[model samples]
Target chain A: MGRWRALANAAFALAVLALGGFGLYQVATRRWHVQPTFHVQVKFSTVSGLEAGHRVRLQGMDAGVVEQVVAPGKPGEPVELVMRLDQRLRHLVRSDAIARILAEGMVGARVVEITPGRPDAPLVAEGGAIESEPPVELSDLMKRTGASLQKLDDLTRTAKTGLEEINAIAGSIREGKGSLGKFVGDEAAYQSLMSLTHRGERTLSAMEDNLAALKRTWPLSRYSDSRSFFEREKVLYQPGSRRDSRLFRDEELFEPGRAILTPVGRTRLDEVGRWCKQASQPQSEVVIAAFTNDDHDVDLAEVLTQEQADSVRKYLIEKHGIDSAGWFRSRKVAAVGFGTQVLRQQDPSLAQLPPRRVEIILFTPQT
Target chain B: MIARGVWQLEQFGRFVGFVALTLAVLPRAVVERFGEVLWQFEQVAVKSLPIVLGAGTSVGLVTWLQTHRLLVANGAESALPSFLAVAVVVEIGPVLAGVLVASRMGAGLAAELGSMRLNEEIEARIVLGADPVPSLVAPRAIACALAVPLLTVLIDASALLGALVGEVTAGKLSPLLFWRDSLVFLRLSDVIPATLKTAVFGLLVGLIGCWTGLNADRSTEAVGRAATLGVVRATLAVFAANVILVPCIQLATEALGLGLL
Candidate 1:
C-alpha cells in the first residue's frame, strides 16, 4: 500500500509537470487554443498596441490569436494583422466580413473584432484579407467633438450679435436715428416714458414688458443701472403697499464725496440690518436711494449719490449676509441715487454743506 | 574578534565553494541516484502540494478582493483581472513558492541530515569508501531545484483558479469573461522566467538545509538549532536571491530581445 501510494504521488507530480509543460508549450508557440485553424489577414490604418498575441474574435466569440504583424515599409501605409481562426468556424467568415480593432474592457488588450458576413455571402478564401476599419481613438474623438463645440459656440455668438443689431435697429426707429428712425420719430419714445409712470397692477411678465418699454425711452441709455433699478421701482410702487423709510445723513455713511463706508455708518445701519433679517419677506423689495444737494454741479451730485447708493447696497448684502439666492424665490433688492433737482431758472438754488441723505426704503406687498 | 570575523568569512567562502561543487557534479549525481531523486520528489513536490495550493488560493482571493475594492473606487474595476494576472503570474507566485518551500522543506532536510550526522552515519559512509555528499546531499538538492519550479507553476495555476472563484463570488464577471480578461494580460515572457526563477530558491533551500545539518555541533541540542536555522537562513536566501535574480533575468531577457512584455 505504501509503495502504491508513493507511485500515486509520483504520478500526480508528473501530471502537474506535464500539464504545466503543455501550457508553457502552447503559450510559447503563441497558439492559445488547440482547435485546428486557418489564417486570414486584416489591414488597419492604425493599430495601437495590437501585438502578435492579441485576441481575435468572430462576432464576439473568442476564435483565435493575432499570428503576425506585417508593418508597412513607409508612412501612410496600413499595418497588416495576420490572424488564425478556428477551422470549425470558417463558414462564419464570409468574403465581405468587416474587421475592426477594439480594446477589451475599456483599457485591456486590443482585440480584432470580426463581424461575420451574411449567410448568403460566400466563405472567404483561406489566407484572404477582409475589410478593415480604423480604430476610433479617444483623443481624435475629443478633438472632433471640441471642434464641433467651437463651431456651435461661434454660430451662437453670430446669432446673438445679429439679434443685438436687430434690437438696436428697432431702438433706432423708436428714438429717431438712421433712415428708418425718421418714420416713427421721438413720439414713440415719449409714449413709452409716459406709460412707465401710469403702469397699474399687472403680472410679473407684464411688468417686464412695461420695463422693456420704459428702457426704450430717450436718454434711458445714460441711466447706467446694471440692477435695472427702474424695473424694480415699477414693481415697488404697487397700490396698497406700505413703504418704511430709514434715513442716514451723508456724514453718517461716507467720507465727503466718496462712497466708502465709515464705521459710524456701519453702526447706524445695524438697525436697518435687523429690520432686513426679521421684518423682510421673500416678496419684499429693499431699495437704497441716496440724495445729494451739492450746490454748483448736478453732475458732481449725481456721481456722489450714485457711489453712495452703490456702497450702501454692497454693505446691506454683504455685512448682514443677506442670502441673495434662494431655492424657491430670490430677494428683490435695488439701489438708485438721485442728484439735486435742476430748476428752470438760470441760477440754481445753492446751499452750503447741506445734509445729503441715504434712504433705505422697504416696500412690502399688501397682505 | 578580528580572528572570529576572519574565520566566519572563511566559513562563508567554504559554503560558496560547497554550493559551486554541488552544481558542478549535479548532472552526474542526478543520473546515478535517479531513485533517490524520485523519492525526494515524492516528498518535496507531492507532500508540499497542499500547502502551496492553499497559500496560492488565498493569495489570489486576497489579491482579487483588494484590487477590486481599490480599482472600483477609481472607476477602473475593468482592470481587476489584468492587474491580478500580472501581480500573481509575474511577482507573487514565484516568491510565494520559494518562501513556502523554504518554510516546509528547509527544516525537514536539516533534521534528516542532522540525525544522520548525530548518529555518525555520515562518518561511517566516509570510512566505507563512499562519499555522503553525492549519495545524499546531491539527490536532495536536485529534488528541490527541480521540484520548486514545478510547484511554482502549480501555485500560479491554483492562484489563477482562486481568482476565478473569487470572481464567481463577486458576480462582477462571468467565468468566461474573467478567463478571457485574465489571459489578455498574461504574457509567456513574464510567466516563463518568473516561474523558472524559483529553481534558484529551491537550490538555496537545499544548500542551506544541507549546509546547516553537516556543520552542526555534535551536541543533541545542535540538531534542533540546525532545524530552526535551516528555516530562517533558507527563507532569507530565497528572498535575497529573488531580489538579485529579477534584474539579472530582466537584463538577460532584454539582451535576447524579449524585452519585458
Candidate 2:
C-alpha cells in the first residue's frame, strides 16, 4: 500500500511538471500561428515612446511585433526599428509605404502603424528599410494650436475695430452727415441726381445717332457699303474661300443680358487681335457680328447685340489701338448686330441653335 | 505587559537563531538522510496540491476578469493574456503557493513536533545520541525548500489554465490564441527568479514552524498554541522574505544586464 501511495505521489509530481513544461514550451516556440514572417527595418527620427515588443499594425490590423529598437550609432542618425511582420502582408508594405509610431491610447503602449502604399507599388523587399514619419509631438501640436488661437484672437480684435468703424459710418449716413446720407435724407438732391442721370443717357443716345449718321455721309460711306455687302454674302459664301470665322459664346464674352465685357472675354479678344494681326492681308476686311438667341423679345435682343458689337469695336480701337488710322492700314474692322435674325437665316429648320454669340469673320478678296 | 513584550522579542531572536542553525546544517542533513527528505516532500507538497491549485486557478480567473474589463475599456483587450501571464508567473503564483503551504504544512509540522516534545520523544533522541536538529528539523526544512518551487510551477500552470478558461468563457478568444498571447511578455528572467524566491519562502516556513513547535511548553494546550503561532509567524515570514528577495533579485538582474524584469 505504501509503495502504491509513493507511485501515486510520483505520478502526480510528474503531471505537475508536465503541465509546467508545456507552458514553457508554448512560450519558447511561439506556436500561436504557423504563419510565416519576414523581417524589415524602419528608421524614425524619434522612437521615444516605442518599445521592442510593441505591436506593429498594418493599416490598423495587428500584423506582428517590433523585434528590436536600435539606438543611433552615430549622432544625428535616426533610430532603427527592426520588425517581424507576417509574410502574407508583405504586399501591403510597399516601397512607398510609410510607418508611423502611434500611441494606442492617451497613456497606453505605442504601436507602429504602417500606412499601405499604392496597390501597384513594388513590395518592400526583405531586409529593406521602409519610410517612417516621426510621431507628432504633443508639445509641437499644442504650440501650433496656441499660435493659431492667438492669430484668431488678433483677427477678432481687428474685426471688432473694423465693425466699429463701419458702425460709425452707418451712424453718419443715418444722421444725414455725408453725401450718401444727403441723397437718402434730402428729396431735392435725390430728384436732381435722377434728372442728371436721365439727361446724360439722352445726350449719349443723341451722340451715338449723330456718329452713325456721320459714318454714313462722307469718308466712311464707301467702307460702310463694302461692310454691308460683306455681311450680306457671309452666310452664302463657300467654305474653301480665304474666309475664316471664329465664334465666341455669350458666356465667353459677357455676363447674361449685359453688354459689358468680362475679363475672360477681354482675354479671348486679345487672342483674336493677335490672330487678326497674323492673318491680315492688304485687302482683308474684319467683321465683328454679334448675335442673340432671344426668341421671346427680338427687339430687346437686337438692341443688346448692337450694344455688344459697339463695345467690342470701341475696346479694339481704343484699348488695343486696332484702328484704321494705325500702321496696319490694310485691316478694315467693322461692327454689325444681327440678333436672332442670323440664327433664323442660317438654320431655319432648327428650333434652337445655341446661346447668344459673337462671330468674328476675317475675309480676304478671293484671288 | 512589558514582560510579555520582552518574552515575545526573546522568542523572535531565538527563532532567527534557529533559522540560521537550520541553514548551516542543511548540506550535512541532505547528504545523510536524503530518503527522509523525500518522504517529507511527498507528505508536504503532494498533500497540499488540491488547495494550491484551487487558489491559483481562482486568483487567475479573478485577475483575468478584472483586467479584461479594464483593458476592454481602453481597447486593449488583446493584451489581457500577456498581462495575466506575467502577473501570475512572476508574482502571484509563487507568493500564493508559499502562503498556502505555510498555513497547511506549518501548522502540521508545529503540532507534530509539539506533541513529540510533550511526549519526551525529542529528549529520548538526544539521550540516544541522535541530534534532534538533523533527524527532526533538517529533513522537514529541506523538503519544504525543495517542494515550494515545484509547487510554484504547478500553481503557475494552473493559473495560466484558469486564465485560459476565463478568456474562453468571455467569448473573446480561443484557447490556442490565449496560450500564445500569454507568452508575449514572459521572460526567463521573470520566471527563474520568481520560482527561486519560493524556496526562500519555504525555508522561512520550515524554520518558523519547527522553532515554534520545539519551544512549546510540555502541555496539551501548548501543542495547539504552537500550531497557531507557527501558522501566523510562517505566513508573516513568507511576506517579509518576498519583500526583501524581490528587490534583491531585481537589482541582481539589472546588474547582470538581463533587463528581463
Candidate 3:
C-alpha cells in the first residue's frame, strides 16, 4: 500500500511538472490568452485612490477589471487606464460608450462604470478604448450645500434685525417721543387751532366795525333813515380838508401859525368851556381810562372826564338829540378833545416822560 | 543562561540552513528530480491562467473605466493607451503576480513540505545519507522561482487582453488604435522590472516554506504549525519585497535617467 501511495505521489508530481512545463511553453509561445479579445483605455485628471485591478462594471454588472494605469507624458493632461472585457460583450458596445468613475456610496468605494454606446454607431472592435465622463464628488456637494445654508442663515438673521429696528421706530412714533411723534400727536394741532381762533376773532371785529359804519350811512330797507343821517352829519360838520396826497396834506393843520384860534373861535370855545365848567364838579373829577391788550402810553392830550363828557352828551341829546354812539365806539382815542387855550402846553420832553405824562393824563382821561 | 544560549543556537542553525538551501537550489536539478519543474509550473502557473486572466481582465476593465471617467472630467479621455501601458508594465504586472503566486503556490508548497516532514520521509532521507535540501528543497525552490516570473508575464498579457475586451465591449475605442498607442509608450523597463520582482517573490515563497518545514518539531502538530507559519511568512516576505524593490528600482531607473520614456 505504501509503495502504491508513493507511486501515486510520483505520478501526481510528474503530472504537475508536465503541466507546469506546458504552461511555460505556452507563456513563451504567447498562446494562452495573450492577445486581448477586446481592449479599452481611459484617461483621468487624478487617480489618487484608483489602482490597477479595480473592478469595472456595466450597470452594476461586472464586465472586466483594470489592467494598467499610467501618467501622461505631458503635464496638466489626463492619466490613462487600460481595461479588457469579455469577448461576448463586444457586439453590445458601440464607439460612443461612456466610462466614468463613481463611488459605491456616501463613504466611498471607487469603481469604474461603463455605459453602452448609441445603437446606431458601429460595433466595437477588439482592443478598443473609450472616453470617460466626470462624476460629481461628495465633498463638492457638501461644500456647496454648506455655503448655501450659511447664506440663507445670514439673510434670515438680517431680515429679522431689520424688522426689529422698524418695530422700535414705530413704537417710538406711537408714543410721540421724537420729531415724528410731534407730527402724529394732538397737542400741536390744538395749539394751531387756538392761534387761528385769535386771528378769526380780530378779523370778525374789524368786519363788524365796517358793517356798523355802513349801517349808519346806508339803511337796509326803504323806511330806514341811514342816508338822511349821513346827510345831516355832512351839513353839521365843517368840511375836512381834502388833499391829493392825504398823509402830507394832514400835517398842514398841525402847523404853528395855521388856523390859530381866532376871536370868534375863542368866544365859541369859551361858551363851550363855560357849559363844560358848569356841568363838571370841582371836587368830583370823573376819570375815563382806555385800556387795550397791549398798552404803555401814559399821555397824549388833555382828555375829558366822564362827568364832563356825559354833560356834553346830555346837552346834545336834549337840545339837539344827536345820537353819536357809533362815532364814539368807532373812534380810536389818541387824546381828549378840549378847548385849546386851557391846555397846559407841556414841553415835549415832559410829555415824553411816563411819570409827568401820567400826572397830566390824570386830569384829562380818554372818555 | 545555558538554555537560552542553546535556543539561540538552534534559531541561528535554522536560519543558516534556510540560507544554504536557497543558495544551493538548482532549476535544472529540480526538473530532473520532480520530472521537470515544468510539471509543477503547469499545475501552479498554467492552471492558474484562468484565474490570472480573469483577475487581469477585470483589472484592465476597471482601470479603463476609471481612467476614462477621470479624463472625461478633465475633458481629455482620448489618451488611454499610454496611461494603461505604463501602469501594467511598471506596477500591476509583478505585484499582482506575486500576490497570486503567494495565494496559490506558496501556501500549497508549505503544506506539502509540512506534510512530508510529518510523514518521516525527511528523517528517512537524513538516515539514508540523502540530503533533503538538494532533493526536496531545491526542487520546490527552483520550481517556484521559475514559475512565478513566467506567471507574471502571462498575467500582464492577460490584463492587456482584458483591457482590450473592455474597450471593445464598451465600443469606446478601436483595437488597432489602442494597441498602437499602448505599444508606442511601452519600454523594456516596464517588462523587466515586473518579471524580476516576480522571480524574487517566488524565491521568497520557496525559502520560507522549506525553512519552516525543516525547522519544525517531530510532532504532527508542529508540521501543521510549520505549514501555516510558512504561508504567513512567505506572504509577508513577498509584500516586503514588493515595497522595498519598487522604490529601489524606481531610484535606480531615475539614476539611469529613465522616466516616462
Candidate 4:
C-alpha cells in the first residue's frame, strides 16, 4: 500500500509537471497551430501607443506578431519595430508595402496593419524594412479640423458683411441718392437724357445724309468709293508726325522773299529727291508746306510762301523726274502756305533759327 | 473596550509570529522528511484535481457564453476564444484554483489539526521529541504551496478545453482553430507571473489554516469553529493577496521591461 501510494504520488507529480511544461512550451514557442514565419522590420516616426507583442495584420487578416519595438535612440531616427509574420502571408508583405499602427476598435488593442503592395512588386527580403505610417493622433486631427471650421466661420462672416454692403448700395440706388440712382429714379433727368440722345441720333442721321450727298458729288465721289460704313471718317485736323517731316531753311534753299530756287536750294532738293525715292511706299502721300515770318504784308507773305512750296513740288517732279500722276499710287502731292501764322506762336528759339522755312511731310497709311 | 483592543492586538502579534516561525522551519522540514512532503503533495494536489477541473470548466463556459453574446453584438464573435484564453490563463485560472484550495483544503487542514490539538496529539508529538512545526506545519505548507501552482496549471488546461467545447457548440469553430485563436493573445509575461502568484495563495492558505487550527480551544465546538474560520480567513487572504500581488507583479514586469501588465 505504501509503495502504491509512492507510485500514485510520482504519477501525480509527473502529470502536474507535464501540464506546467506544456503550458510553458505553448507560451514560449507559440506552438498552437504554429506556422512558419519570417522576420521583417518597420520604422515609424512616432509609435505612441503601439508596443511589442501587438498583433500584426495583413489586409485586416491576422498574420503575425510584433517581436520587438526599438524606440528612437537618436534625434531624427525613427522607432523600429521587428515583426514575425507567417510564411503563408509573406507574399502580401512586398517591398512597396506599407505598415501603419491602427486601433482594433475604438478602445480596443492597437495593431500593426500591413497594407499589401501590388502583386507584381518584388517580395520583401528577409529582415527588410517596410514603410510605416505613424498612428493618427485624434487630438491633432481635432485641432486641424477646428482650424478649418474657424476659417469657414470667418469666410461666412465676411460674405455676410459683403452681402449687407451690397444691400445698402441697392437701397441707396432705389432712394435716388447716387449718380446711378438719379439715372434710374429721376424722371426729369431721364427725359432730358432721352431727348439729348434723340437729338444726337437725328444729328448723326442728317450728317450721314449730307456725307452721302457729298460722296455722290464730283471730286469727293472718287475718295468715298469702295469704303466700308464701319470705317472712321477722315478728319482734316489730324495730328502731325515730326518723324516723317523734313525741314529746309529759307536762306539754304531759296532767295530772300522770292519763290525761285537758288543754287544752294537745288543741292538740298537733290538730297530730298533721293530720300523721297528711297523712303516713299507705293501708297504713301506727301505734303509740301511753306511758312514766312514777314507779318507786315500778310497777303504778299502768303503768295510768296505758296509760290515757294509750288517751286519745291516742281523741282521734285521736273528736276528729279518724280511721277506726278501715279506717284505714291495716285495720291496727289499738295502744296500749302502759311504766312507768319505759326511763327508768332512757335518757340522763340525755333523762330529765331529761320523765319522762312518749308516742311516735307510723308503719310503712310496703317495697314 | 481597552481590554478587547489589547487582546485583538495580541492575537495579531501571534499570527505574525506564527508566519515567521513557519517560514523559518520550512527548509529543515523539507531536508528531513522529503517523503512525507511528497505524501502531503499527493493529498493536496492529486486529490483536489476534480474540483479544480469542474470549477475551471464552469468558469470558462460561463465566460465564453457571456463574452460571446457581448462580442457577437459588436460583430466580434470570432474573438471569443482569444478573449477567454487570455482571461483564463492570465487571471481566472490561478485565482480560481487558489480560492478553491483555500476553501476545501484549508477547512480540511484546520479540522484535522484542530482535532489533533483537542485530542492532545500535538502534545504527544512534542513529548516524543518531535518539533511540531517540521513534523506538522512544514509538510502541509510546502505541499499547499507546491500543489496550488500545479492545480493552477490544471485549471488553465481545463478552462481552455471548456472554452473549446463552448466555441464548437455555439459557433462553427473547430477544436484546432479555437485553440489556435485562443493562443493569439497568450504571452509568457502574463502567464508566468499570474501562475506563480498562486503559490503565494497556497502559502497563505496553509499558514492561516494551521494557525487557526492550532489556536482553537480543546473542544469539539472549537474544532468546528476552527474549520469555518480557516475557510473564511483563507478565502479572504486569497482575495487580499490577489490585489497586492497583481500590482506588485505589474511593477516587477514593468521594471524588468517585460511590459506584460
Point to the candidate with the largest lDDT.
4
**lDDT for each residue of candidate 2 in A1-367, tens digit (9 for 90 to 100):** 3678768877877887787676666554452133588888999989967876677899998787787789999999999998888888887888888999888754467889999888888888897888999898888899999999999999999999999999999999889998899778898998999999999999999999997797556457446644664564464354554767777887888887899999999998888877776775777777788888756375566678878988888887667655553464645687877666653245453345466788778777787
DockQ of each: 0.15, 0.23, 0.02, 0.22
Docking verdict class for candidate 3? incorrect
What does the lDDT read for residue A254 in candidate 3?
A: 20
Is candidate 2 or 3 superior in TM-score?
2
Candidate 3 on B1-261: residue-level lDDT in tens? Answer: 999999989987877766775576674465467664545545566567678778877888888888877766775555676678668756887778777777776667667777777788888988999777777777667777877776666666677787788778773679877765565334444456656777889877877777777767777787777767877888888999999998888888768754322
Regarding lDDT, does 2 or 4 come out ahead?
4
By descending lDDT, how would the candidates be arranged?
4, 2, 1, 3
- Across residues A16-125, which tens digit of lDDT does each residue of candidate 1 receive? 88878865764544444456789899899888888877788998987888878899989999999989888988989998899999987646669899999888988988
lDDT at position B172, candidate 3: 66
Candidate 1 runs further than 4 Å off: A18-33, A117-123, A170-367, B1-12, B71-86, B111-121, B170-184, B187-193, B216-229, B243-261
Instruction: Using TM-score, rank the candidates from best to worst.
Output: 2, 4, 1, 3
lDDT string, candidate 4, B126-159, tens digits:
9999877889898899999999998999999888
Ranking by DockQ: 2, 4, 1, 3
Residue pairs that clash (backbone atoms under 3 angstroms), model 4: none
Q: How far is candidate 4 from the true structure (C-alpha RMSD, Å)?
A: 18.6
Q: List where candidate 2 sits over 4 angstroms from the true fold.
A: A30-44, A51-100, A105-107, A112-133, A150-164, A186-367, B1-13, B71-76
Model 2, A56: alpha-carbon shift in Å?
A: 5.7
The local distance difference test score of each candidate is: 0.81, 0.82, 0.60, 0.83
Cα displacement (angstroms), candidate 4, residue B167, comes to 2.6
Give a tens-digit lDDT track for model 1, residues B125-195.
Answer: 99998787788888889899889998988888899889889889884888877865676556677778898
Query: Could you tell me which 10 consecutive residues in candidate 3 chain A have the lowest summed lDDT?
Result: A242-251
